[model samples]
Every structure is written in C-alpha cells, then in structure tokens.
Target: MRIAYLILCHGQPAQIRRLVMALPPSSPIFIHVDARTSAAVHAEIHQLAYLRAHIHFVPRHRCFWSGYGIVKATNQLIISALASGEAFDRATLLSGADYPIKSQEHINAFFENAGDAEFIEAFPLHAPNRWSNHEGLYHGASRVDWFHVRFRSRAWRSPWRRRLPLGYEPWGGGQWWTLTRPALELIADVARKHPALPRFFRNVFLPDESYFQTLLGNSRFRGAIAGDDLRLVIWDRPEPPYPAILKARDIECLAESDKLFARKFDLYRNPEIYELIDARFLRRS
Candidate 1:
C-alpha cells in the first residue's frame, strides 16, 4: 500500500523535520507551507528537506486563523498528492505538529485491510451530538446561511437565506482526515464539475471543517466512511489553545490510544514529550 501524506504547516521547522523523518520514506509527502512564513524559517525547512526528494512542497498559500485560506491550502495539498503519479491507497492529512503514534508497519497493515473506506470525522449538521464549540451552528439552515466571522467591519448578510450549492447536506467535523483514493477523487471531481460548492465555502467561518467533509458525506461514499478521522486529538483543558499541548505526563494515554497520529505537540514548552514519544513509540524495536 503506497500511502500519501499531506501536511499543512506554517512554522516549527524542527518539528516538521522530525515528523517527515519518522514516516515511512517509501511513501510520498506533499507539504504546503504558509506563504507568510518568514524567509529564515522557510530556509531552515528547505535545508532539512533537501536530502529527501520524496518530500515535496506545493506553492504556498497565505493562511489565516479560522479563515478560508486554510481550506485553500488543504485543497492544494490534496490536489498535489493526487497529481503525483502514485496510486495511493490512503492519503492522510496532518498538521505540522502531529506525530505518528503507531509504528510504520502497524499503520501499513491497518490501511492494507481497509477496503475502500473513508476515515473522516463527520456528522450531519442536524445531529444532536454535534461538537459543542460550533455553538448553535449545528442548527443553522445551511452552510451558506452562516455569516463569516469577519463580517462585522463592513458586514453584509445575503438578501435571502442561501441554500448549500449543489444540494449538499451540511456535514462537518475536525479538519484532519485520512481518505482513500476513491473518496479523494470524488472530492476533486465535485470541486471541478460543480464550482459553486467551493464558491459557497470561500468566506464561511472555518470552511476547512466543512468543505471536503460535506462533499464526501453526501456522496455514495457516505456509508463507507468510518467517522473516526483516524487521529488522536484532545482539548479537555480548561484554558484555551485547545488540542491541549501534550506533555511528558500524557505519554501513557497517547500511547494507549489506537489512533494512528497525535497532534499539537508544543516543541518550545516541553521538548521532553517529543523525546518520550520517540523513544517509546517512534524507535524501532
């Protein structure tokens, strides 16, 4: 199984290097660095990537927090991975801070047995159990009915409540996912044939969580979706910066989880967690 990895990162050159090195080198890596990344930081990333020709970077997109740019960069990464002349059974999306929790062999075997299933965290917009942070959005009329977070300074609402383009049922969840080739192609095809869907998502609040998700959930592939997202992410802390910056103390929990990858490791605050994860899970037996 030739798995492809799509990574979207803005900073943390060192952490990115470690993540790239840890993955199976036989697989292709398609990365999209933020266009606004400092030249110095980009150079640092480039230097580390020079030796690994299989690790490719797409043209940078100027990303903004909770902005449409996140969706654009993610789209670029997916398109790049598909364009790469490789027939991949799985294409896993990851953040720059994410690290593999399982060994390369374990990950491969899991995907090998995964027959045509799409692993995305998805739920209907009307689901009563929708994520709480989305606040009343689960009850919104549709994706286009919601106002952009930046709609205030010169805010404007549509003349009439707009329905989701192409008749897609609103479905979304955490941005991370691992998709099979069929699911990926369907997403790309929808975007290509029906340009209206992408247009509808452009300025919507956090389109990254909805765009591809809504596309797949409404398709014939819906039944095949696992709804797991295949990632171990946490946000239980009381304070902000959710997806809590994992620490050395959290090792046992993370290691025990069946998730293939874990996210949001803060290299600055506690590098020890990285070493701990590496020694216990990343190192070869």
Candidate 2:
C-alpha cells in the first residue's frame, strides 16, 4: 500500500533527510518548511528533494509554536498531498525531529492490517485538562478577539467571547496522527465549507491540537479513529511546553514500545541514539 508522509519542518536538514530516506522510497513526501527558516536550510532541503523522484517541497508558512501557523502549515501539507491525486492508502503527519521506531516494511505491514482505521489521539476540550480552567468558555468564545492569546501569553485576560458556529463541538489532542485519505478529505472539506471556523481558530490557543481532533471527532469518521497518534513522546513534566529530547539511554525504551515513531531528537546531543536505532530497528546502518 502506498503511504504519503506530510512532514512539517522548520530546520535541521540532515535530520529531515534521514527521516525521508528511512521511509520507503515509493512513499510520496510532502514537506512544508517554516517561512522563517534560513535560506541555507531551505536550499539544503531543496537539494535533497531534487535528487529524489517522489519527494517534493510545497509552499512554506510562517509557523510559530502553539500558534495558528502550525494549523496552517499542517493544512497546507494535507491539502497539497491530496490535490496531487496520489493513490495513497494513508497519510501520516510527522515532524523533523521524529524518527521511525519500526522499519519501513513493518510500518507498511502494520498499516495494511489496520484496514481503514484513523490513528489520532484526541479528547473533548473540556476533559479536565490543565491547559484550560474555563473549558466551557471556549464554547461561546471568539478566541481570536481575545488579547495576547497567542504564544506564551496567558489566556486568563481575554477581552470578549463569541459562540462557536452551530453544530460544532470543541475537541483537542496531540498534533501528530496517521489518517486515512477519506478522513483527511473530510477535514479539508469541513475547513473549506466553514471558512469562519479557520478564522475563529486562528486566534485559539494551540489550534493545531484542537482543530483536526474536533473536526474528526464530530464527523462520521469518529468510529474509525484508533484514539492513539502512534508516537512515543517523553515529557519531563506532566504539562511541559515541549517533549524531552531523546538520547542514547532511551533507545531500549523506544524499541520496547509499540509506537511507530519517537520525537524531539537532537543530532548534536544524541546522534548515537539515532545510529543505534538505525542499526537495531531500521537496519540502515
């Protein structure tokens, strides 16, 4: 089965190249580099893609952490991949820092057995998480109109609130996922049909985490969801802004997990971890 990889990356060309090469060459790779990325990094990514037949670079978006830009970049990658008219069985969203824990053949075989299930981790927005205290307020609040809601600013001092459009419920989850083509098309259709949804979410805190989850959860594909993003991420604290940077000591734990990918690796700090993974799991060394 053909799989399309939608990678949202900003920097680290070497790491991205390793990820792309680790996957099956037949898999179409659609990369969206952050608009703020350095020209040198962009050139490096371009060179890598130029040498590969199926790897292509799409338009870049100015992505900011925990901002609407994340959702924008992700949307662009998914839309571009679908528009390419590729007959892909599934589309997996990944980041530059992530590496595969399973070989390409194993990943493909796992998906082939997965049938049409969607692999997304999600929960209701009001599910008693530490991210928000006034979860119900999100229902009738225009997160965009609020002041200083983007980035590291607090959400407590919002100016005003507006109700979400009818027939929409708030949902949130981790940003990465593996989805069937129909599930992705459904999300794109929802965004296309409800232009206001995007505008409203543009101001919401970490919209990337909530937008796709809310749409997929409310749609008919909810039943197809596997409820797991299939990525093994380690957090230093229960509610940390970023995941812990993986290292050599984590290789065995990563291998033991059934997860397909692990994230937040730094070549400068833990190049050996990746080499070990490649030798033990990916068999590319």
Candidate 3:
C-alpha cells in the first residue's frame, strides 16, 4: 500500500528541501505553502525537483489561529490527493518544521498493523459541563470555542454523546494525523454532504483539534480510529501558544517514544536533531 506525506509550511526553502531529501522518493509529498510568504519560499519548493509534481500551493489566505482556514487548507490537501488518483494506502499530515521520529521501517510496520483504522489520537473534552463556569462563555458555546477552555472542564459534556457510533469527543492535540483511504473518504464525504459544516466549524475554538476528531468520532467508522495523535513537542518557557523548539536534550526522549513523529524542532539549535533522526530514526542516506 502507498503512503503519502503532507506538510503545511511557512518556512525557508533550504530547510524544506532538506526535509524532502530525507524521505524516500517514491513516497508522494504535498505541501501548502502560505502564498503571503516571501518569494524565496516558493523558489525553494521549485528547486526540489522531487516534489514539483506532487506539490500543491493552496490559495494564499491569512489563517486565523482559531478559524476555518486551517481546516479548509487541510480539506484542500485531501481533495488534491484524492484527485491525483494515485490510490495511496495512508496519508500523514505534518507541519513544515515537524520531523518524523520513527524509522520508515517502523512507520510502515505500524500502518500495516493499523489497516483501515484512522490514527488521530485524541482525548475527551467535555463542554458546558466543564465550561459553564467561565465568565465570557455562554451556556451553549459553539464547538469552536472549546479550543480555549477544553482543559478546564468540570465534568464530561455528555458521556452518552461519546457512546454513539457517531459520538462527540474532545478534539485537542497535535495537528498531525495518519488516515487510511477509507477514513479520508469519510471526511471528504462529510465535507461534501454538509456544505455549511466547514463554515459552522470555522468559528469554533481550536477547530483544527475538533473538526477532524468530532467528525470522525461521529461517523460510522469511529471504531476504526487508533485513538492517539502521535507526536512529541515541548512547549517553550511560559508555555507560549506554539510549541518549544526541539533540542539535543529532547532527542533521546523523542527517539524512544516509538511514535511515528515529533515536531517543532528549531532549524538552527536542533540541526543535530535532524542528524540524529537521519542516523537513528530514518537512516536516510
């Protein structure tokens, strides 16, 4: 079965090229480079002849951290891959700077074991039951607002909701995910059937976290999920909104997670992380 790598980035070309070279040539790559980024970024993508055919430049738009754009960009990627008609077996969505922490051999083996199941690790995030106390939040907070207050809930928003074949679950975690073709199709179908759904979800807090999780959890294929979004990221001092940059000290822990990937490595301070990954995890030539 084929595996496709999808990365969304607003970074330098040399860095992205280095990442492209790190993966197998046969594995398809799709990138959504924010158009508003500098020209050098686009040029770098062109330099990587390997990704030229698979590269997809999404329409340039300002992505709100808690808005619909993130999901829209992802949906665009899914549509592009399906339209490519390549019949891939699995798909992994990654960020521009995120790197894989597992060897290709291990990654392939994991997917082999998880056939037909969607690998979108998630945790329970109850709503109103937990959010009702917040001063600004309303009794009927839209799913979008959970992005900011999910961790503070006092009780399950509703456990029975999670029991349905298509139940609701809290959606907050790393944006990366590995989806089988069937799961991808399921997501696409939902997007198609409900024209207003994407817009409806765009306003939700942390929609990226919930949009996929809630949709899949409420689908007939919910049972097929692997239940963990696998990636290691350390938050910066004071716990900034973005994750901390990876470093040498974090390498050993990341290597041991046995998860498929780790993310947010510092391009400068963590070149060694890349080297360590190349030498240990992926064994890139």
Q: Is candidate 1 or 3 superior in TM-score? A: 1
Considering every candidate listed, which one attains the maximal TM-score? 1
Model 1 agreement with the true structure over 116-146: per-residue lDDT tens digits: 8888888776565455444443333344466
lDDT of 3 by residue, 1-285 (tens): 568887777766777777777665568777777655678767677567655455545454445555566778888788777777666798889887878777777777887887577788644445434334544333223344332323322211322111212334444444679888778887898889876666556445556766787777667767877776677767645545568777777778886686777777666756777887788778775
Candidate rank order under lDDT: 2, 1, 3
Candidate 1: residue 216 Cα off by (Å): 0.2
| Residue pairs with clashing backbones, model 1 | none
* Number of colliding residue pairs in model 2: 4
Give per-candidate clash totals.
Answer: 0, 4, 8
What would the TM-scores of all predictions be?
Answer: 0.91, 0.90, 0.80
Model 2 CA RMSD to the hidden true structure, in angstroms: 3.2
Which window of ten consecutive residues has the lowest lDDT sum in model 1?
151-160
Collision count of model 3: 8
Pairs that collide, model 3: 121-227, 121-228, 121-229, 130-154, 144-204, 144-205, 145-205, 166-218
On the 0 to 100 scale, the lDDT of residue 28 in model 2 is 92
Give lDDT: candidate 2, residue 248. Answer: 92
